[model samples]
Target: MSLNRIASVRAVLGISLTLVLATFFFSPSYSMESRDNSSSPVAGLRVEIKQTSTSPITITSTVVNDNDHTVTFLVYNSPLDTAAPSIGLLTITPDGASEPLDLPKLQIQRQWPPSPESLIQLQPGASQTADIVLKDFIASKIAGKASVALKGRWDMVWNKQKDDVTPEMIEQAQLQAEPDVFSGSFASESVEISPA
Candidate 1:
């Protein structure tokens, strides 16, 4: 082919390839918002639990927010309420057993939508941790066990709607606007622990 003809052919192929790539990458299925609304506040919230110490039988649990927006929610394993039994933080299952250890669950009596000030808000890409001392449940129960697996789950604690919100509730919270509750349960990978 002539030099001019070859150059025109190359330009056409380059333009076609660019359009195809842009269509593929920018499509709704590949967009960040499509994967469970990844741009939403609740997207990619992860929970992780690790055995910190054997003496006190402590477990360090962390909740990481991977989304771009802030998330507001509650955690039973709050630092202030460390002594209280968690609502649905960690579940302990022995290596060979089918049933999980009966860890006490804390029951709260509150209004439908929890107090705005009562909720915990985490910024985008930030993480919150609760170091739980499982001495009461683990030390005695899993004593001398070769290894025990632990799974941590964070459950959405509220069922309130936008209508249930009050004006004063918004003013009291750290979030200036009406906060969308980060709904859904996030579970961590099962971590194996060896107790002495």
Candidate 2:
């Protein structure tokens, strides 16, 4: 590749890395249909959530890749809505409650190569974290309690199954997931975000 091309590639990758870290923080959360898997384990992936603030109710999510191989994730798309996004893809349960709070999900939409731009590849031992601020009704429910338990999940569907696929098409293959990628979910211990 020419020097210019290489530089651009590096720049893009750098931006992507930054975005992945901020995906949770900046990505606008809308009422869309995004799929969430049941609690399962894959390649030693771990997820955790914490309440960063109580004034407006802020929650942060951290995803760590413990596998030796690289894993890519589909950073979700934020719809038009820019209201208070309650939290990440985790289920919220009040302390001493049997079940978690109910929240709406977005529809699953996977474009082609262009879409994979939202995907982030995490190398072994690498982690990405982002936080969301909540001021909606959900925040009101969780306020004045002590702490609320949060559940976190990670799902992966690589873009390549059989070799022979082109270099450019690789990311798309993973983004599509197409039931080919192994999906797993795990719940995390609660963090104190609410105050009495």
Candidate 3:
């Protein structure tokens, strides 16, 4: 090819490559969907518990969603059961140390099904806060540098339908589905617990 023709072809190729790169890097939907598949989806689901009184403890959580899909939250007992008398397990370690904590059985309560009575649909970069009340679940003595570890296995379902799939079918499929048998710690934080 002539020198002018070669220069023209190189310019066109460079422009096309730049456009492709911009599309891939600047697309919000693509980036959000990519994060949805990873643990970033659960990063917003944080829980904080404190002993507000001798008999009652206050728990707060900020559940954020940075995706374009709806998510449902369900709270269940540790070891996760659909049956009644479901209880969650909370552990506390003193002075940022990883050791067994001596604690008694406690009662933790969560608002069933969550409020507003609708599926939580999060637009791009949306978030919300959830408050929980925990009662009869505070240790009698908590002092010095300590780390509180709270863990609960709650069932969650993605509500957004795939292309060409019906919501009715999804519900029916869930009815016949088996529970996932995976469990791990969700969130933990170090705190200074003062003596009351």
Number of the top-ranking candidate, with lDDT as the measure: 1
Model 1: lDDT to the true structure: 0.57
Tally clashing residue pairs in candidate 3.
Answer: 1
Arrange candidates by lDDT, descending: 1, 2, 3
lDDT of 3 by residue, 136-176 (tens): 33343344545554566534444332232334543454467
Give per-residue lDDT, candidate 2, residue 177: 49
Residue pairs of candidate 1 with colliding backbone atoms: none
TM-scores vs. true structure, each candidate: 0.55, 0.53, 0.44
User: Whole-model lDDT for model 2 versus the true structure?
Assistant: 0.54
| Residue 195 Cα positional deviation in candidate 2, in Å, after optimal superposition | 5.0
Tens digits of lDDT, candidate 1, 38-142:
334434667667778877777676767675656655543333134433554556776788787777676766444456555556676778877667655545777
CA lDDT, every model vs. true structure: 0.57, 0.54, 0.46
Mind giving the per-residue lDDT tens digits that candidate 2 earns over 21-81? 7876555542121321221225366766776676667667666778766666544521111
Which wins on lDDT, candidate 1 or candidate 2? 1
